[model samples]
Target: MLINDGLVRARGVRYATASRFAKPEPLAWDGARPSERGPACPQPPSALAALVGNSVEGLSFDERCQVLSVTAPADASGLPVMVWFHGGAYVTGSGESTKYEASLLASEGVVVVSVSYRLGVFGYLRDNLGLLDQLTALRWVRDNITAFGGDPANVTAFGQSAGGDSVYALMLVDTENLFHRAILQSAPLGTRSPERAEMTAALRSSISVDESTSVEDALAAQTAAVTEVGPKFPPSGGMPFAPVLDDVDLTAAASRVELLVGHTADDGSPYVPSREHWEAVTELIFAGGARELARDWAAACGQVATYTFRWAPADAPLGSCHCMELPFLFDPDGWRGAGMLAGQEPDPVLAGTMRSLWAGFARNGMDALPSRSLEFGG
Candidate 1:
């Protein structure tokens, strides 16, 4: 997307543009429609990718990988937008992954924009640059989404895992009307981020590339392999990269935004080794954290609702583990490659239910139907 909205930021105006991303020149456009998937940022090997043989997890890395995709109905205008940030523990994955082909969601009425941002050291270590990238994208959506037939006033920022953390960050950072709704899906909200120095030292020790390998290449490789299922991830067995909480940002007046936050019934099932405290793990790490955030927001701003996704595919050993509900929620047809979600229970009827709920929130600022612990039994 060509940046046609830079100058507006220099003025005292907090917003960047009426639309952040402009239609690219012919050669610059990657495909017929912006919704066609684009390149992913650099990341290392992922155990998740290895499991499903999903190339997206290990797609070739590119530094200039800030492209985004938008899916919208051909006849629609002034539609609500759902801006998605893909999850990969702050180090892996991309919005370009086919697992996020939001066409069906857009087909239901609203527009969907899946975005890409810098990961690992390029984004977090030297500085909090990844989040800066995200902020820039959100600002772009605010200014340019209208061109894509989206309503700037009715936007919902949502994501799962690391992306969910980013949605939380946006809630904390965006006081200037960027998005009116926020959805946090299976985010490790309570896991404290490790120090950059510690993470760097860990990477420096774990990496064993060829002697001639550049420092950046080694770091990137290590970062990719060091994900949740990887041996070196969580740096020292906990989350590594995170937004440094500025007392100013954390303590900002509560966002004037509604919240729809939730987690899988067993978010920690895959990440945590033992099933003994899996329930506790979910509560301590994701669900409980969201509750605290919701209570805090409800007191400070608008309405808040929380639900647990309890659906399970028959092949799933652990019920509703991390990201197991995503395929049904975003793209049931393209969800196959993610390994975490199998085709066991993804019927069109189920997908339609999820679509109805998500679309309702995006359009109306509240859930059309209250979702308790929703169960998609196999």
Candidate 2:
């Protein structure tokens, strides 16, 4: 049930909801088909459309906004659409990051939309204010997707880490009817109280501003403070920048989405300052608090399809690190062993297998194909 804020205005001719989700009939390509042999590539400039708009929160400048699209071949009817939010710990990254290239999914007849929202102080610092931004993004997608050849009723929201956390939050407070399914990678449900406290403290210290300071002033102080800290990860526990149980956007309750959640075997090493840091984070994020949180999360999910991926490809480096499966999934040859795709080699077979599984999940509520060694229902 979408509560129209009366702020949403459609620019194009209003298409009836019936035309939005109707199954598309397949079309045939008359020209020479491009090579579908190697990694899927984006079609040339002519084939894609671009969209820009204010965030759901209504905070960002009109020009500083979002992007959505239909990337699949035009002929593919009834293709599923995925709205992807990237992982950056609520601080960094953009929709334009190379790691999120959606060509592979697009090639498989999925319309992929990558979003750009406010980051760091701009998006997350409002105590409970930032949630509106996320909600607005979802609402925008819901109202405008049909124009881009997507099914508004069949959308799936998927993300990694912080983005994954957002997926869960969306399900909880999401009254906009924005998405029907969810995929969460390497993110657990909640944070330890101590960890939350620490994050709040760090944000406060960085700002050095009163808790009651105006959002604009707080953002200015935060930007200056972080610049002095250099590129290092901010000290944890500073501000109420992350999602919290506000009873408005979130109700301190569990969510029910067809969840596909898991962590890589070595998800903690990349941020480790030393072996001890590695051990501590692993204990906290995975074995310690995270494990307990997972139990509670499972209870909330009810009859969920669950799985754990222990991917240790032979070519991977010593540490599997966060986001290691991306290159394998996208099979972007150059991106192999860098950023999220670090510690991976280009494996066509693995890429194909993973893409098919993702597509299947987006198309239906299934986790993955039966043929793949991918496990579920644990």
RMSD (CA, angstroms), candidate 1: 7.5
Tell how far residue 216 is off in model 2, in angstroms.
13
Cα lDDT tens digits for candidate 2, 133-179: 55666676666566545777888888776677677677777765678
Cα lDDT tens digits, model 1, 308-352, are: 777776766666788776877776655665556554646678778
Error of 1 at 345 (Å): 3.9
Q: Cα lDDT of all candidates, in order?
A: 0.66, 0.50
RMSD of each: 7.5, 11.7
Clashing pairs in 1: 17-143, 18-143, 18-144, 19-143, 19-144, 20-140, 20-144, 44-224, 123-130
TM-score for candidate 1, residues paired by index: 0.79
What's the lDDT for residue 340 in model 2?
39
lDDT of 2 at 247: 37
